[model samples]
Target: MDAVADHGGSLGRASALFPQAPLPWIDLSTGINPHSYPLFDLPATAFSRLPEPARERTLAEVAAATYGAPSAANVVSAPGTQILLPRVAAAVKPGRALVLGPTYAEHARACAIAGHTVAEVRDFDALFSADIAIVVNPNNPDGRVARRRDLLELADKMRSKGGLLVVDEAFMEVGPLDERMDGDVGRGGLVVLRSFGKFFGLAGVRLGFAIAAESLAARIHGELGPWAVAGPALEYGIKALGDDAWQQAMRERLAADAARLDALFADSGVEVGGGTSLFRYVKLPDAPALFETLGQQGILIRNFIWDETALRVGLPGSEAEWRRLEQALAAWATRRQERAMEAQP
Candidate 1:
């Protein structure tokens, strides 16, 4: 089961693994906002027509403003950042690729797909030697952050040698704002990937962006050609990205929820590891046990294939969901305490 566990948001696999678990499971897998943006009415033309070029440009402008890019020219909107991974990796001719590790698995996979000799490296300095280097800002699951100065220095070094540095800012909405590299992509050799679905809670929308210098941005745009984004995605991106008031309020709300989750974990005797507001990281010796307990209770979270003592649990949506999680933890806590006592000589 550990080896087969792939990406998050897969209830089908969860059901298959734990067939006796309750129905209507609580999924806390991906770092997606549970309190999603309110669905709005879309015009009939959205589904009936091919996306308009003007709407694409408008979406780019909105993304540029929302993500702090220099201009719309520096942004290339795509269906999702997942699809753009290979496109960005293929920007420079295939060579060696280094991804900062124990992070998202897709970066290494995408680089390999682009015909690069991909390696996941622990040392930040080792990235400088690769033809393509990748980093996940406020890194996934662990929330490890890289210094802005260090990243910029690396970008400069990569640019000097015609290499590329790809920064995935998928979690930056709730991350440390000071270490953001979104504004520095204008200097070249750096391409920043931003996900609309994670922050806005619209993963089904399939919208994301790549920010880079004009030339590189144009290269990605050329590969995408026309109508890369759905009309509904353009509509949502325009409305959601433009709504700063909602974004600010949601950030505050998510912060409070994350704090509540941390307290719940601590009270239940599980010390939380670092994570962004959207998810909480847990490093426990008995992670598989906790996973089994929660999965039996119909609550599925993220577990890593590479690390046995790792789990990534996202925020629950409502009060009932919260209570369910609390109850599940209470049971796990009692069981853990009994096991500890029995093991004591």
Candidate 2:
């Protein structure tokens, strides 16, 4: 397997690489929510002055309630989970790190950057052997969810060795509630990372949270310093987190969209691996070729270097985007058939 890219959502890179492909690219390369949360006009102070500590407190309170965290003190807000990954790794002394893999590449990268000897392991039992272990629940690109019981058990084992279990629940909002470990933050060395942007479709807001015991949360908070969250992010995050109705509706919408995407892939003769509502993972020998084909048509989906057969397709926001994707998939099917015919003996 080749080295995986650090992250996705590079529209500029796509445009530069495929300049002649098309204009107004339809990006399905990330798991970010297609239908973003509605925004409203912000108060002048949201930009002119520093964010009020009271507003930041309200944001944490809302986040704690929204994520079912133990308490507001246990929830430390950050600009985004990506920034906190390394911060969390740094807070803990450098030690053996095992990142459950073929998942997000950042966990291992962060750990290694923090000066830990990092290894990507496929087995859950590897958790017992490391000082810090990271698992992306509803695992990225593939959405393989580890059982809550298994996670708790592993956390307990790691705790006995004075280790930490970092569970990245970036997509868990679209998954089952029982699979979440946020409420277990203070128990047996568990830390939960939640992304506000992925579920809310406001990636540019740059907001995320770390739910842990107060001591560890304080360590992360201190490292981040004051004003870790932006003024507008604090304002918007409070509203979005408290809006239970919108969250519920968005969940239903994402579920339907995911099912529709799955059916579309199946109809186009693509074999889908497991996935959550945010994205579907397709495993095909021609994934790289398909990725290029889709890019040529200005349809950008995520392709993996770690596994050449894997492609991650996110939901299209509007009807026109859906039709565009459908047409592109049909074109791919037609081209595949032509290749098959040419190879026939």
Instruction: Choose the strongest candidate by lDDT.
Output: 1
Point out where model 2 deviates above 4 Å.
1-5
Question: How far off is residue 299 in model 1, in Å?
Answer: 0.5
TM-score of each: 0.98, 0.97
lDDT per residue as tens, model 2, 1-345: 234465668898898778888878999999999999998999999999988888888998999998899889999999999899988877668999998888888888888888899999999887788899999998997889999999999889877888889999999999878989999988858899999999999999999999998999998899888888999999889999999999999999999999999899889898778888999988988888899998999988898777888889999999999999999999999999899999999
What does each candidate score in C-alpha RMSD? 1.9, 1.9
- Clashing pairs in model 2? none
Candidate 1 on 114-175: residue-level lDDT in tens?
89998999999999999999999989979999999999999999999999999999999999
- Supply the global lDDT for candidate 1: 0.93
